[model samples]
Target: MPDTEQLTTTTPNVQTDAPSLPNLEQESWQQLASAADSEADPFKTLVVATCTNTGAGARMVVLRQVDVIRKYLWFHTDARSEKVIQLEAFPTATLLFWDDKQQRQLRLVVETRLHTDDYVADDQWHTLGLGSRKIYLSERKPGSEQPAPYQGFPEQLGENLPTKEESEAGRKNFAVIECRTLSMEYLHLSRKGQTRALFQYEPESKQVWLAP
Candidate 1:
């Protein structure tokens, strides 16, 4: 049999050297910014967790935009959705991102602001194609009980995408969620060893390695 220990050490994904704190922090933000621009990136889909009146809520949302310099991120949602309401009531939320290929996970604490019927919303709305705009055209509110299984958009459209004129109706329901990152926790899993670090952006800037 082959030597398993030697093979593990030779794996391409295994880290050969310890990275400096500053380098690790820079790497984390670079990956985040890249994910926002690339749809194929695994980190493009992230989970947003918010505090509810009773407990908490979590859901997967696509990464729409990222500003590494300012440490801001953006995602879109329906203005009438439960998440929007929850965010309005509790502006603080957590964003969780994981990239299986890189074996990295990022947890970000952020302060959220809703942009509806504003230029921010308008710009994001214009960027979305008809296919994405269709969801916002639903007459019924999101999370509402339905008598039968219903697609979010009009049934008549079926698989067809809405025209720009038709999609305009959805603008009223579309909303942009702007998140200002307060802190970020990074974790990397590897057969060789695990690495963890924390970066704070608010109150005071700080970075520290944590026991993994």
Candidate 2:
């Protein structure tokens, strides 16, 4: 009789290469630009944190546009929303992005400027499709109390999109939030090791690696 031994296989830890401190700024901006262009990109949605009279507030918003050279990020929101008020009161905010597939996170310190009735808002409004514009047609402002469950837009539409003329009504409610990036902190998680870096764009330009 012969004896047999059992064998087991172990999976290797995943390792992600970290960008050099010098190149981190460029790479991060490139990623953000791509996210702004691609709807499926996880980074297309981010947490925008703002200061309130009492404390702090945070909400998820879609990434509308990115100017890599200018280091500006844009997102659309209701002109009458609470966030718009908060941002107007305190223009500084923190924009946070996380990509699960890449195991990466980006925290951006930004100064916000609201554009409600300017060419900037008009340009961004024109880019919205009917589906995206539909919400702006709501008679009630965002976060308004409802008798029951009210869809943001008019209930009569009932899943139907508004025409260009009909959608125009929403233009007054649409607002563009322009975020000027002051600094960005990048963090990458890997089984092998973690990487963290900071890139400052305002006050003074600087890049540095930090302890992860």
Candidate 3:
């Protein structure tokens, strides 16, 4: 029988040679920044889950920014989206990240705050490219149905980029969701065994390994 006690790797920035709870947490923060900047990083996109009247709602969003010291995360969304409404009502959410290359999953519990017309959103908006800004220019609110299947953006524009003046309309719909992480749960799967740990940041800081 093949032994389930060894593993090999073909990815970068994944270390299992000396894995520890603190080391794993440190690597997660570093990878968050790398993921945002590097297109090849699998951690660039995360699943954000929010509370809904029915149950739970989840969607994939690009990881835009990371604040390591403050343990904050940032993602952009349309101000009129259902997720925004859900967050405004619940304030607390979970961010789930899975790295297929690393065979690991990181779940973060966070308190969310919306920034629509504030400086935070304004600053981030200025950094966005015209392509990204155009997404917010839809005539109808996000998730709204159309009579004859309307494209999200104006069909007249087609593949052509919108002018700076034309893109200004999107600013009103643009928002930044700032997430302050309260706790992080890390799980790593390996052929030999599995490793799991929990890091608590709120109320008091603590770290403990868990059985996987």
Candidate 4:
């Protein structure tokens, strides 16, 4: 096989073709896009870092959709989640994604814009299957009460999935995280090689495919 690090010898020769965007960025995003889907990898989530009223915190969330062409991403969460509250108070948030198989890490700085009401929330809600929709069935709001050794689910039959009747109520729980990407940095470690690159999309424009 050709050395991917040496794009001049690789099949795609992407480095020579696009001097701005690194081939590593292109490859990683391609992997992410290919892996991102409701069925393919439902739990393929990123650890989102959102600032709190006092400090920083992070939580894992399922990856929703990726727009490579326009450079954007989306994720779903409960309306009452602490992350949501923090995001509303502080729109500046950062997303961290790690691909274990690829040994790659991506850091993205974005601005959050809630997608509620109108067709936005409805469209996403309609696409969710019954199994995934179950998350919206929680009786108490997320991060709300604390009782004995609780796993955060209401006491009931247990195996709970959103029913047709509860779907409407779920509409209020639905939230879309719109990430207006400001910059994306990529780092990859491999047995054969390592690579690092930083991409800037605001204030000034720059991209580099460098030695790691």
Candidate 5:
């Protein structure tokens, strides 16, 4: 249930503005930007679930970038990333984001493009801090078997990330994904109950507040 503030908005396109639409969009993007800049344990910061060939699915990845005006999102991966392989076979994916503090959930349906070339990959690689770049420097690719359950890198480097030169090995494996968001659904819980809305941005613009 929304606040008793009882503000209503009507947009020509959405058939209703309800003031809350812009409020929701603004707050949503602000929180999204914060999540993108998270400094702690960045893994699974934004999980994108994708269906690979044969109908298997997987999730858990970080959010690398966001273009609010353009409504596009990005994430980094290895050229050997399983998600990349899956996206190659099926370009559709769903991005799921939940913010506990706000009790908000965002679901985005997107079309994905993978870039493995040097120029594009280098652009993303240059932005990665030393700690993150170290993950890509492993001798074996991601998902590789461990001879003895290794720490994903040499023992001496345990919890100690490698230097720039050391991370160079990962440069060759860097991959960037561009996700054009097609639709965005938002859910927020309030004392009243729950408020749900759908914002569609592709093919045509659409917005709807549904009964929950």
Candidate 6:
């Protein structure tokens, strides 16, 4: 059998024939933008990690909005969730994304702000479908204890879609989290080789290949 060649010895931060950082940034935006309808975009559900007094707080959240020009991302959550409290105190977080098929990972550093009683929240809430709104209609606060397992929403509602008037009740608990991305780190893994790069957006915009 012939020995397979290894390509991992390539020097870091060398801008040669590889894809440019701008192209990576644009590709990330396109994936996030189309995630709602494209199952191929693993960014549809990314892991969000935040700082807490005890340690790190992490959870999986759906990607709601993407602003390519401004480098902002948005996701919706319950106003009373533990993460919301943590974010209120820390105001910063890391978003991690992985694409199994592409063998790629994206790490995004971001500054976050909560928008529960603002126009941003209202606009986002308005676009949510009944299925998504039902999550906010929980009778008890999130993470509450129960003798038996709870479905979050009222049992009577079952799987039925809530009426517009009924869904309005959820608006109070709905919250939109606005995230301003400061930097993005990209990594691609392959048996043949690996690629890494960093794209800085805040303070000043710059891109550089990074040591994998």
Using TM-score as the measure, the top candidate is: 1
- Clashes (N, CA, C under 3 Å) per candidate: 0, 0, 0, 0, 5, 0
**TM-score per candidate, in order?**
0.92, 0.91, 0.90, 0.80, 0.83, 0.89
lDDT on C-alpha atoms for all candidate structures: 0.93, 0.93, 0.90, 0.75, 0.78, 0.88
- Residues 1-212 of candidate 1 have per-residue lDDT tens digits of 97677543454343459798899989989988999889999989999999998999999999999999999999999999999999999999999999888899999999999999899999999899888999999999999999999899998999999999999999999999999999999999988899989999998999988877
Off by over 4 Å in 5: 1-19, 40-44
- For candidate 4, write residues 34-88 as lDDT tens digits: 6567445423678899998799989988877778877778888988788888999
Give the CA lDDT, 0 to 100, for residue 131 in model 5: 86
- Over the stretch 29-62, how does candidate 6's per-residue lDDT look in tens digits? 7777788555467888999999998899899999
Off by over 4 Å in 1: 1-16
Highest lDDT model number: 1
Better of 1 and 3 by lDDT: 1
Model 3 spans with C-alpha error above 4 angstroms: 1-18
What lDDT is obtained when candidate 1 is compared to the true structure?
A: 0.93
> Tens digits of per-residue lDDT for model 5 on 1-212?
87889788885333242357777777677666666777462322877888865776767778887888888888988787677789998999998887676677888999999887767677888899998887777667677776777565556788887888888878877889899989989987767467788889888998888765
- Please, what are the lDDT tens digits per residue for candidate 2 over residues 117-206? 999999999999999999999999788887898889998899899999999999999999999999999998877798888999889999
Tell me the lDDT of model 4 at 155.
53
Better of 1 and 5 by TM-score: 1
Best first by lDDT, ranked: 1, 2, 3, 6, 5, 4
Ranking by TM-score: 1, 2, 3, 6, 5, 4
